[model samples]
Target chain A: MSSFDRNDRPLVDVRHLKQYFNITVGPLRTKALKAVDDVSFSIRSGETLGLVGESGCGKTTVGRSILHLYQPTGGEVEFEGRLIKTKSDINELRKKATMVFQDPYSSLNPRMTVSDIIGEPLDIHKMYANKAERMERILELMDRVGLNSEHASRYAHEFSGGQRQRIGIARALALRPEFIVCDEPVSALDVSIQAQVINMFVELQEQMGLTYLFIAHDILVVRHISDRIAVMYLGKMVELADASVIYDQPLHPYTRSLMSAVPQPDPKVARANKRIVLSGDIPSPLNAPSGCPFRTRCPHAAPCCAEAMPEFKEVESGHFVACHRVNEL
Target chain B: MNKRFTMHIDVDAFLPATDEEKAYMVQMRPSSTFFRDGVKRLLKNKVATVSLIIILIITLSSLIIPAFWPYSYESMLGVRPGKSVDASFNNLSPFEYGETEQARIAAGETVFPHIFGTDSSGRDYFIRVIYGTRISLAVGFFASLIVLIIGMTIGSIAGYCGGKVDLIIMRFVDMIYSLPDMLMVILLATVLKQTLAPVLEGTSLARIGVNIISLFVVFGVLYWVSMSRLIRGQILSLREQEYVLAAKAAGAKGGWIIRKHLLPNCISVVVISTALQIPSAIFTESFLSFVGLGVNAPMPSLGSLASDALNGLSSYPYRMVIPAVVISLIVLSLNLFGDGLRDAFDPKLRT
Candidate 1:
């Protein structure tokens, strides 16, 4: 496992991942909820890929699916170029990948001490040799995540919201994994706390050479931290490109609108930019449009857009856009 | 605010100590969180505390006192069967002897050493009542344990694993829930008495074992379905928690996940539910015994004593009142204790 190539490659690679939940409507009737429909992306080693989308756009689903939290309906997950197949393979992959959940208040076990919470992953992995080593590791993790070492003995509910989130981060970092799926880790935190946590994530990634799938609804925050950004709308990845290009050029109309929606601190630039309010609510995944899931809400939809779902193709250097009218646009 | 009032409010609102001071506060955790809450709730429930005290006294006296009855319960004392408590039973002096057959008996009927009085058989009613506590407490303790183990194991497995396992386990639990609990206990007890009793005649311990095991099984299996349902509901909610998912993401296996994450979260529910169910289990056992299906003859459980009292209701009302009061007191205390525990452990109800 150690000899596996680590020079310069994607730390985690997910290709065409799909997660569908079957909902029972009546005695015999059933409906497929395509929570994640053929979503694909990759995170290079030491790079942060921010996944920005609305609540139902399958952002969290993508993170969970990538970690095999929800067994994918169909897809391939490659970790460090090794293909994951069986449960054992997934288990092996999980050792190198972990998720920081959206809700800081609930992510940590309320009954557990900070030591136990952070020590859990190590205990599971059997990373430490003895009790003293385990405690030392836990305290080290606490210090790494900006938590005081003395806080290890205290239960999660005893801590403030910010402290809890830090404890959550410490738990995620316990295994010292190369890649982490941060699913809205700071969204439930206070504004001041969110910055501190986000900065801590950046610092840790640099220090540990970690890759991250940073999922959030806040585009500005994502753009600030991400090397590349992926915009998802209703289970479809509309655009994927460098953070600057995604914000400045934003090839897909949906991406452009989302970028425009971010409130610019400069009042003049903010007022001048037209807010592209999506015409209607996001379509339920059950009855998503036949072609191009986003066509129902895209302001620039055409007849071809309804003909069939467009291929997710690289339209320019490293910029992938999945829309029928990409050529026309 | 006055000092006392401020202290009162502070006591209720006291937060768990911070990590910086946990070393100094370690011993105080249980006292502050569990004992403080338990004592406060117990103090609020006056009836439960009174019954608890009575049970404590009964248990202490029964365990420490001598076995011999100072005066027999079945023997006719000076008091005739229907005589008033203030008159024939209490009127005769302990030192006096009867002159004639009728007056001798009447004078002999004096209270004497018969604190609980005599039953129709003339055995000390008080002594039998004290002895009955051992059986009642045993049934309560063991039967509740069996039910808890079955419920926790089945419920946690069903809930944490979910899908078909949950459906099958829960449906079976529902089926059990539909049956009359007492009816099941009787049917099971009857089958055990007929089939196993004869086989166990060779050994004394075996006989006791068969009796107790059958009794425990009868009540345990009958009552566990509700506990299972409770644990499953708790686990269902607990399984969705982030710690469980985090545990999974950490490569923790399913068994380890259940043991470490799911079980700890639901333990409070199981414990409080178990405490509440003990009295029911004991009551169920007693009811079966009273109806001639329970602990058998010579052992003398509260239910069997009450059974005898029921037979001589008109002749010796004391026979019924003593055991009946003891049984009710034990059940009431257990219920109050369960309530106190529930209030202490249940976060939703806690301030």
Candidate 2:
């Protein structure tokens, strides 16, 4: 991994990362729920990799695993030429890598003033020489995030959703991290506010030269900022490619169906767009299919689909798809 | 390719002209902390404000009134060595004068009037009541402090650690809960009074009396269970909040997370619970004293004063009435103040 070219190497290199939770099903019985199973992706320096899936498709889990938020059951994440396996490695990675959580309301501590919330990372890492320097840094962060200096001493509950999200972003940016996993950072806000927050995120990324793994269920929002996009089904990554290629010519059956479900805005285009309605409900992760996790509801499922999970393979420049009938489709 | 939705605009047109406008543009208010905001809300509540005033007045009177008053709570005004019990000084009603005081007034000598008159022992009843208020308030505050310290520590540890530690502590809490509180307190106080009497002989606590020590011991043993359970419930919910997770993500250690995030969020509950606990503790101390298991004689706990008054109830009903009224006033004001604190501080109750 260290042999990779400095300029070309990804800021975050995640390989086969898995996160499983053991939940008790009965009085004495426990089962492993594979929240994130053998998921692999990477984000280059100063690039945004968008991860899109339905609510329970493990998109957030993928983001969290890369940051070592939940200790991975298997596989490894290499951040900036460092294998994040040991506690010290993870702690070091945290200084350079941070997360902007999904819910603004829950992410910022209500009892904490905005200054303390944003200054927490600095305090943890001792980034300042004195109180004055710390306050200056916090004020700088607030300014970058478009928050007023006066907001520095106000509580989280006093802000609206968009402002609270900005505060969360300021805290995430406090350590001057290079990579940030933005886990649905704007999903909890109103649609009008969502666009503003997303624009702010993009602007911040450009100004700071930051890398992002933007996770969301909304493909349109993901496409707006993502340089490349990965589509996940259940706990598996089904497709990955350039953002335009993934939206324009998605290859996997699950990807095709997912693309078709997105509502077209133009009336004429909407009439022509045939929505691929998936027939069955998403199978419980507790009782996932024997082979492909998406086989139960795939429109093009076959006997071979149940025999084994299809390998994710790149069939064209920068376009990867995981499906048995990828060539035929 | 999707066409970019770009519009030519002058960005500076949106910029604020004045510094104040820039500050106000981001929906920012004058900076204040959670405690300050809570206090602001609390001061705005009329009932709570009045209750707080009443509590301050009573507390001030208790502390200061004893210093300048002409009479001592324990001093027998008319009794002297080898003198017969001063019949004229016994059981005078409020503002009434005994024979000596009446004669002094007629002779143009200045005599400090016994405002609440004298008790059967010829001691000034008003001073004793003042002293009793002081003792009760101190006991209530100290007892609640003990409960708060023990409860906060155990509850946060249990709530944060969960699993085995939680189970063990919660079971212990349950065991304490199942015990009959009053009966246990009485039994423990009686037994402890006997055992602690010798141990406390030379210490400064000896002045506090054996029954008072036993009462504190009973409080330490029994009263903390409710506080711990309340705090545990609060911490259990707060520990799972995403802010705690965010704190963890920021590389905050467990203790720091608990101190900076979890505890502050749970402070309103802590404040309200501790406030409510004081009146109950005072009530419990008075009850123990009433049953002869509280502060020893001559200290004049409100309950002891009332109990002594019972023997003279037929002759002077006001004897028992005075202490009873004082006890009710103190308890009522504290309870109302607690309710006010809850209404003011609790975010969940905010409109």
Candidate 3:
């Protein structure tokens, strides 16, 4: 959104991305766990794309697959219009793109000092010419993330959750990456600290002209950061639109229910809001309902809705939905 | 500032923070690394501290005492080339003077008292005990070191690679596991002794003996399985840590990730396992020595000394007691100290 030409090609384009993990069900029998099935989306350069869903809906898988952290079982990921296919391409992609993991405790190497953890990316890419230059860059990164330079030599365990997350952000920023996949970077923090980290992400994006694929289950957080939002259910994307349009005029039944579920802060708005609580728990992806994975829970389900999967198609200029009854609803 | 509310806005309070204020707000803790923290915790444990001290005393004595001792480890005090053995020197009890030594004392000369007395050979039993300690301690440490190097390498490779590599390496480990442990050690020791004797005959290594080298070979071949399995399990879990993934995301290679992230996380396991391994390695060396596969004759390993003491047991039980007590003390102190180190460095046990 920050001065990216509206007509320029998207910085990242995912076409029919599929990620399936094989699990041994028995001694010789194996079954595929379709973690992300036929998900497709695109994010313009200098824009934030928010991916939202409940747990186990493959939102995180989509982020990881784009980074080639998990080799996608099928389809293509295009970065700067180049197909990310070869090992070297993935390595090249890694330099320009990075990720901020979900759990701060598990994300930073526990044995490393704060300086080493933040300097790891620099060391990996050979970014600095000399030791003093490396130290200078490390101090700059730490300051950007609001960490005290004095904390450099201390191990990660000495810091609180918020501070550890700052260290993670510092590492992600060390390579000066253009694209970052933030996999619930703030969900692990307290609500008060979450705001600080999210604001820092925004500030960094503006400062560095960075692009982000922000994946989270927290709808409010996604709404706050995303220029455009995509909703996924059971490894399939249900809707995609501008953040405000999705929140205000959701078309798909699942997206409608998800939107209604957001709590209204004011008593008057709370009384006026109609909460569309779904009937059953989300079915496991391993045995997700055939045709439309959401058909079993869709209130507007018909015989036709269960016979063939709905195609995710654009109805308006920028809004997309995948429901057979988009016209009727 | 209270500008958002209908109240007095303190513009001074809303001013940007200064360097002095930020520095004051930092409240930084003293810088500490993982090793320093582990050591700090280790010193707080009394049992571990005492055990560590006892090990130091024993190790220092074994290393330093032989340099200045009066009698050589193998020199027989009373035998000459053209003369018969001085019969009284052959089996002198503790502090007892031999026939020639008594004559020397009567002639205003001096002889050092045998603290553990003479064995059947008439060599100074005290020096033999000291040399035996040196051999035992050396074997214990060197064997464990070999196991650590081999096991850590194989384990990290197998664990980080996973899949087919993991399957093949793990099967090989299992195959080694199925072998009869004691039989393998004895068989390898005998075979190594036979093969290495001629090759080592003229080398400086001849002083260390073929049997000790065989003991090391046995440990390298068989004893590493447990350490490998331990490190493999540690790596298997640690490789899944997000830091490893983060490194991978930063385009770091598998070897780099294993070295920078996986191995460092499991250092506690390595230290603790190696410490525990020393005692067992020492015990194995002694057991092999007891069965006549220990260090060569005249070298005086604790097990070989004890084995020789069997010939004089009825007349001199203390010879048996002395070497046996030394072995037991070494193993005991090592075991206790290893436990202390584990308690100190283990992440779960960190205070």
Candidate 4:
């Protein structure tokens, strides 16, 4: 599975990434909460891989771990063919890979002016010749993100949510990164403004030849921008396929149920669509089930499902699923 | 591939008529820094503005008036070399003339009237009050500065470096908090006065008195706990903000992040806390001075003057009333100003 032809090298390759948070449940009792367990994926250059999951399914953790925002408890992240194993390697990777956080309100420093917030990365890297050059570059970035030069001196709180997200994007783009983990960048935005911000993201990618690990819970939003989509169940990846393939013909029962839940715009299609609501709450990661983490809630659970976890294996070209009943289906 | 969709519309109609109109489309408000904006809001608050003015007037008079005043705070008005003390000059009421001054007035020689009366020692009461205001204001400001420096340093360090460092510093803070503040202050002041008197002898600080030095020491030792705790709480919350993470992700070092991100975000809290601390420091200094542990004799603090007036309280009550009113006025103004600063500068209170 480590085969990458010279012509198709991935920008970021995360293999067997595990992030287990040791939470104190009681006095002197610590339990490991596996937030992202054995999650493996690769993002090709100039492409977007949408990571879709429920709120606690570790989609955000996957993005953060790849960026080394949260140190992974196990496994490796390779950036542009170099294995990131040390602090320096991670720091080097940060120059080329960045993140746009979910909440624009909380993500930006309220005291910082727009220019200072955006120019921070450049200042950190010492990328400019002088103050004049730095200001010019910041203004150029503001213009690229459709912000006026006059907005440069204004603080983050003075802007609307969409505008603040634009400031965040400008900050991310300051280093001229090749890859960015857009962690639900538009989730907190209004429906009317979400499309506009998403469109700007798409335009930025096109202009800069950037790759994105776009993590979002909204499947429809993910499908709109993602070339490939991966669905996670609990802390594990359940399905990986091309966006169109996953939407048109979902193989895993969980993926099928997820697709069925997206409300169709057409009244006839909406009336015809079936909703598959899973039973029982998502089990706590501390006390996860023995075999498959999702087995208890799976509709097609079998005796074999309780014995061992299903291997995430490729079923067809460019499509993968982890299910005990995949062959029978 | 060669097809050109030519849809002709009225493009000229939408164009601006003049360059000014074009510029108007993107006009922006002139930019201002946080400090300037805070000042703008503060100036709009009438009560705080008036209080600030009063404080300024008092401070300026204290600094400038003593230089040109007709009588010295420490000199007896009618005492001279080789002459018996002129008892009639002592305790002259406000706007009253002594025997010598009245004789000079009868001789058609102009005599300066005693303003706010002479003290029992025959020193000018007005000059003493002015000097007292100066000392109290100076102590309040300097003590607050010392507290700010100590508290901000310890708080940021402990908050940023959590776990063992935080625990140790916090326990130390708790120990300080549990101690009886006033009793400790009084004890420290008394002990420090005895020790500092010899060390400060013949130095300029000796003129300010050993008691004032001990009062400052007491403040330095006891008054910084609240400030440190407040700053520590602020830094704890601010260090977790995503901007701090973003700064870290951008390769900022710990000190750099603390300086550029953490401290600035909680600057409103710092300003408000420092402002509020001043009045408490002033009140504490006055209270200590009232108990005879403030500035040395011959240097009247407002509290010491009130203490002295207690001897003649039945006969001349205004002496006590005057200094008490001044102390209340100064503390009340500072507190109201601090409230206004919180209202104006605090981001949490902003719309």
Candidate 5:
């Protein structure tokens, strides 16, 4: 984990962010699916904030809301100490930030050549002055992502998944973006390719001094790249800390169960690590438990746990947990 | 830890690959695009190839034969401005000469033989049929193109701007769907033909006549609903593609995304649907002409020609048969070609 100075101002600050999607339960009856509920976090400059959670845990929502791909239902998103309120501000934020999507097969325009795909951002932002400049920028970007100039004329379907992902990454770097929201960018790739992509991401970060809001369900990948990690349950952030601290000492019950569930690579350690298999299925977000989203599955759940949500407070320097039973457990 | 074996390579064996060897190792493929790939697949399909050839032959003859063929579509050979009627020219059988021409042949004067002979009006039947083929093909192609442009534009706009825009456009399409197709086309044709006649009186548009113009209007108004609905469905599914999202995230505008991302992805569906639309347009024009709502008097259309042939049914069945065969050939070949196109271009059906 790379350490950041305590006084370094956060590059992107999200204040009590919330994203709610209203769905009709029946004819004329609507209810809110709180996809991300009042979750707040910040990524310091050049930091990798790996967001790890279960499938429907609003991790991707958190990433998208920061970039305003999905407008937050409530809250403020401040980037580089400026509040993103007006249209021009959002446009500015877009220029400095971009996204790397999951599903490389569907993330690329099949009809366009690889050069056009990588040059799309430059075209959109009007960053280049002339055709030559644009072509130069596109070629430089393609080279940076390890693509041959000869391959630029081919379409997305002609390439393999890892190569297609490289195209996506090259596109993300098109605008010389300072931050990228990589939403499960490598989860759809083969196991061998994942390492190559993750290492490339680390290399890109170091070279370009770029920041990433890395969202994934795969813990090992997150642990490999993340400077700090945030864990979510249902729609709320359960724990946040340095990557090493969260792995060694996961205080929240949900976090503890999540850590215990990761299979150890060594046989002896795997046998020694006890799995805390929680009882019951994951409750639908629409009908989530009233207080403490994890209370329904928490082993130490008291009647008081169902009354109100616990506060996410700092229990130690740079370690935050949202559990009432943090002291005893 | 002690190594049991020392791993080493000879300095002499570490030579870099030669340029030719490197080139062989890379093994690059020649660049190709989706359109080129589709065409390659199309050429490989036997039935499609034959259908395309038939269409080419028919369409070319229709376009070319009218240039040099003797006799006009409207000229009655038996009735001259200042001469007595030559009744033998009327209703002559195929390759048969008129009476005057027969007399000339008896005097050792060569007389041209009538290829398909004359109709009841003593006009050249072969030239009329050729002109009718040209008109029918024109109406079919132009009408289908009109439908395609209007349908594709509205459909993409509605599909890309979902929620209220989609709801309103879809409901309008449903309303159009509910209207009886035949009744609407007939009513529109009648009304438009009457109105366009006067408007076309002093203009260059009068050459094609009011009926054909109204037929195009009818097709534009009525036939595009189905095409639009098809395009809308295609774009609805395609707009959700992640490429569109990536474009949006990069701050590309809606129009840009639609042009660069959405439309190109669904191009195969657009092409196949447009090809299928042509046959129906041709059929609609024929049916309209059959109902006497097609080309005006003296402007031959296949349907009107067939209707005229109905009077001499027993005597000149070949008249009706010729246009009918031509229409059938065009529609069938076009449909087969469309199927071949679907098989060739559709990524889902690539195997």
Candidate 6:
């Protein structure tokens, strides 16, 4: 365990992380699915870093890999200056970094009461001395997640989708974690309740001084909540930058196209903005594009874009982009 | 993120409720028919309910009634053989003393007492058959309980901890299952009786204890193979549930995980298996006894009584009919009861 300086140290620091799954597709044959390949990012203490990409783009894989939920095939993950290398290290890492799942209804056990679910981490980590303190902590978590204290005695299936997600949140918060992985946390929620849950997340972040890697496909949600944003294609990250710069002054052609697609609230502006529609389905990660993954669909693609993989570099302060034709664009 | 967006989201609200309460309310919700209708279908099964009641009553009677009746079939009534006796004295004896009374009467004719008739030894077949119910039911029940324990423990372990252990255990179960049921039960019971008979010969209680222990050993070992197979299939599937993964992530050990999650989830199937096993065990024990491989003479079991009736089938067919009917009824009731319980406990059927 490393000392908590609280001022300079980032809550989580990941470097060149790679996680590949060996899938057996035939007799005595195996193939690697590059689920999370050469990914690098960091979440500062008390800041939210949103990860945005389409389905199957390995956004969720990155979050899971960082948490050591799936063992990384390569690279290093350092939490508060301490490197995670073994099972015990990962177990200890879980105390500071926990995850909330995508499907709220399925994430929680149907058999467990709300209190037990919330107190599970506490029990595992031995966070409380007695039953009374455990009960008190459970009630406090329920209240923090906007659940009434009386609801602790009931099972998860009895609640609505939103309530179940709240219980999931309470569970993630049980260990008093410094960082959390919100894996499409509101994707299974109602559109109306999504705002409430999102607001609650922001409030918790402020109150607890927590850091987060909020993963989702919704650009508007990501832009609103994240201090910085990272975009991915296939299994590789293509862009990383401040949320406003990535949204407003996006340099990567993929980022530009994504931003153009989101409908602005002002109808006049929305009507005026050109929709840059990209063609063709995403290439499978098993046989990804040779160079820039977006080149095949890039409107401004050039011959050099197909020769070699582009290096991810910062063209402006705090704004990173990977493209062979960035100079031309 | 969009604080001003007010899209009317029809939320599916979950209130924390007990399982029973959740089930009832879910039934009342009426959006889906499967959950509520499944429960209704199970409740409508009449034969299953009746069989359950019959079994409960029979079990209670077998346990309770034996304490009050201390009269063994071998006990003599102290009346002179071929001598005319009072009707009351004839009533007290288990067998017919009527031959002497009739002879005296034809010397001056009179009726005598002979309820359910008699064997050549003047032992009461009626009282003996009644007493035999306890032995038959006991063999069925305790043997079935042993089978259930062995089956569930072996099955859950094999299924949950699949690999070399599962392969070895399942092969052993298969080896036992490959033998013919009747032949194997007879062989095992014969071996047990041979070993225990000398030590158990002196007292009635010892004789009864030997019979029970032999029945339990033979049937318990034989029947567990099928039950173990059933529970193994159930646990193999149940261990994959997300709740199991959740428990593991929560740091629960393998034993606690199996005890709290795996066993409770597989209970309905195990229960049905046990119920069905009871009747089959009784039938096997009865068949062994009928073939002269079960408990020996002076201790009447249903099979032994039926065997007696078989020799005098032409003159007194009632002897065979009575015991056979009881055996059939018990097996039928057990099947009905098991089927009913399976339907009721099935989660898919709950409407």
Whole-model Cα lDDT per candidate? Answer: 0.79, 0.87, 0.91, 0.88, 0.89, 0.79
lDDT of 1 by residue, A67-155 (tens): 88888899888998988888888878877899898887778876677799899989888898899999988888888988878667777
- List, residue by residue over A188-230, the lDDT tens digit for candidate 5: 9999999999999988987888888999999889998998999
State which candidate has the highest lDDT.
3
Candidate closest to the true structure, highest DockQ:
5
Model 5, range B232-332, lDDT digits (tens) per residue? 88888998888988998999888998888888888898899888888888888888888888888888888888988999999899988988998998899
Q: List-wise, what DockQ does each model earn?
A: 0.47, 0.51, 0.64, 0.44, 0.66, 0.20
Separate clash counts for every candidate:
11, 0, 0, 0, 0, 15
Most TM-score-accurate candidate: 3
Please identify model 4 stretches exceeding 4 Å from their true place: A1-6, A265-275, B1-47, B81-86, B98-100, B197-208, B344-351
lDDT of candidate 4 over B1-351, digit per residue (tens): 899989888999878679888778656566677889899999999999999998899889999999988888889987978999898888989988878889999999987777899989887898998888888999998889889888888899888988899999999999999999999998999899889889998999888778888887888877787888888898999888888877776767779888989888788888898988888988998898898888888888888989899999999899999889999989999999999999999878899
Candidate 5, which CAPRI tier?
medium
Model 2: per-residue Cα lDDT over A1-329, one tens digit each: 11122355777788888899899999989999998888777778888889999889899888888888789999889898778988898888888888999999998887778899999999988999999999999999999998878767778888999999999999999999998899999899999999999988888877778888999989899999998999998899999999989998999888888899888889899899898888888888887898888888988898999999899888898788889889887
How is the predicted docking of candidate 3 categorized under the CAPRI scheme?
A: medium
Give candidate 4's error at residue B327 in angstroms.
0.9
Report the TM-score of candidate 4, chain A only.
Answer: 0.97
Model 4 chain A: lowest-lDDT 10 consecutive positions: A1-10
In terms of lDDT, the poorest run of 10 residues in model 4 chain B is: B25-34
Native contacts conserved, per model: 0.77, 0.71, 0.79, 0.56, 0.81, 0.19
> Between the candidate structures 1 and 6, which one is better when assessed by DockQ?
1
In candidate 3 the C-alpha lDDT for residue A189 amounts to 99
| TM-score (0 to 1) of chain B for each candidate | 0.74, 0.91, 0.92, 0.92, 0.92, 0.76
Candidates, ranked, TM-score: 3, 5, 2, 4, 1, 6
Candidate number that wins on lDDT, 2 or 6: 2
Poorly placed runs, candidate 2 (over 4 Å):
A1-6, A190-192, A263-274, B1-50, B79-88, B96-103, B198-201, B349-351
lDDT of 6 by residue, A69-112 (tens): 67899999999888999888878887878888888876776556
Q: List, residue by residue over B259-309, the lDDT tens digit for candidate 6.
A: 877887677777777888888878877887888876657777788889877
Q: By TM-score, how accurate is candidate 2?
A: 0.89
List candidate 6 segments past 4 Å from native: A1-8, A123-130, A291-296, A300-308, A314-317, B1-44, B70-132, B157-229, B292-301
Tens-place lDDT per residue, model 3, A171-226, is 99999998999999999999999999999998898889899999998999999999
Give the lDDT of residue A286 in candidate 2. 81
Q: Give me the displacement of residue A13 in model 5, in angstroms.
A: 1.4
